[model samples]
Target: MDRFGDGLVFVVALVLIGWWIWRRFDNWLHEPPSSRLRKLAQAGEVEPDEAVDFLQEHGYSVLSGKHRVPLGVIVDDGPVQTTRLYFDYFAAKEDRYYLVRLERSRQPIDWTASGLRERLLPYALLFPECDGIIVADPKDRLLRTVRFRVEDEKA
Candidate 1:
C-alpha cells in the first residue's frame, strides 16, 4: 500500500506540472503584441504627405501622422480650460521611434536649447517611450533629432 500511495503522488505531481506548463504556453500564445509593434503594423494605414516624404528622405520611416492630444487644465481650482497639442508625425529609424514636429511659419520653433526645452520637451515628456523629438524643417531641407537628459545639481 505504501508503494502504491507513492506512485499515485508522483502521478499527481506530474499532472500538476503539465497543467502549469500548458497554462503558460496558452497565455503566451494569446497575449497581445507590444504597442510599438502595433504602431508599426498600423503605419501602412497613414496617408503619405509632404512630412512623410521628408521623413523618408532622411532615412526614417513615417509611422503615423497628425496626432492631436487634448488637454484640460485647471488653474488654482478655476474653471477648466481645454486646449490641444499637435504632433505632425511619428517616425522610426533603426528601431528607434521619434515624435516628429514640422516647423511652421505661424508657430516657429525656437532652436536654442532653452527654447527647445520649452517647446519640444513637453512632447518628449508626454511620450516617454519615444527616443526623442525629430524637428523636420522640410522647407529648409533639414532634419534634426533632439534628446533630453536630466542632470542633478550639486550644491
Candidate 2:
C-alpha cells in the first residue's frame, strides 16, 4: 500500500509539472510581438519612420494597399468575424519588390527573429510583387532580410 501511494504521488507531481510547462509555453506563444517593439521605440533605440524610409530611400516604391480579412468572431455569431488591417510598406525597384516590416524593440535578438518570422512574414506575402521581406528591429539596429520564391502565394 505504501508503494502504491508513493507511485500515485509521483504521477501527480509529474502531471503538475507538465501542466505548468504547457501553460508557460502557451503564454509565450500568444504574447504580442508589438509589445516588444513599442518598448524599443519608447527607449529611442530606433525611429519608426527611419526603418520605413530606409526601404523607400533604397528605390523601392511604397504600395498603398490595405486588406481586411476575417480572423474570427470574438464572442458569438452576433458579432461577425473581424480582423484589423494595417498597411504593408512595399517598394518596387526594377523587377524586385521589397516588402519592409518595421518592428522596434529592445528585446533579445532571438525573440525578435521569432516574432518577425511568425508575424510579419505572412503580412509581407500580401504583396504579389514582393520578392523579399525585411524585418527591421530599430532598437537593435539590426535588420534581417528574408526572400521568398515568386511562386509562393501572397497571404
RMSD of each: 8.0, 18.2
Model 1 lDDT per residue over 19-43, tens place: 9999999987886544644454365
Output the lDDT of residue 44, model 2: 22
- Report, for every candidate in turn, its global Cα lDDT versus the true structure: 0.83, 0.56
Could you estimate the TM-score for every candidate? Answer: 0.71, 0.41
**Which is the leading candidate under lDDT?**
1
Task: Please write out the lDDT profile of model 2 over residues 1-155, one tens digit for every residue.
Answer: 99999999999999999999999999989986544423322332222466556655555555432224346556754777677644344445665555555664543324455665566556555544455766566445666667644465786
Relative to the true structure, candidate 1 reaches a TM of 0.71
How many clashes would you count in candidate 1?
A: 0
Kindly report which residue stretches of model 1 are placed more than 4 angstroms away from their true locations once superposed. Answer: 1-45
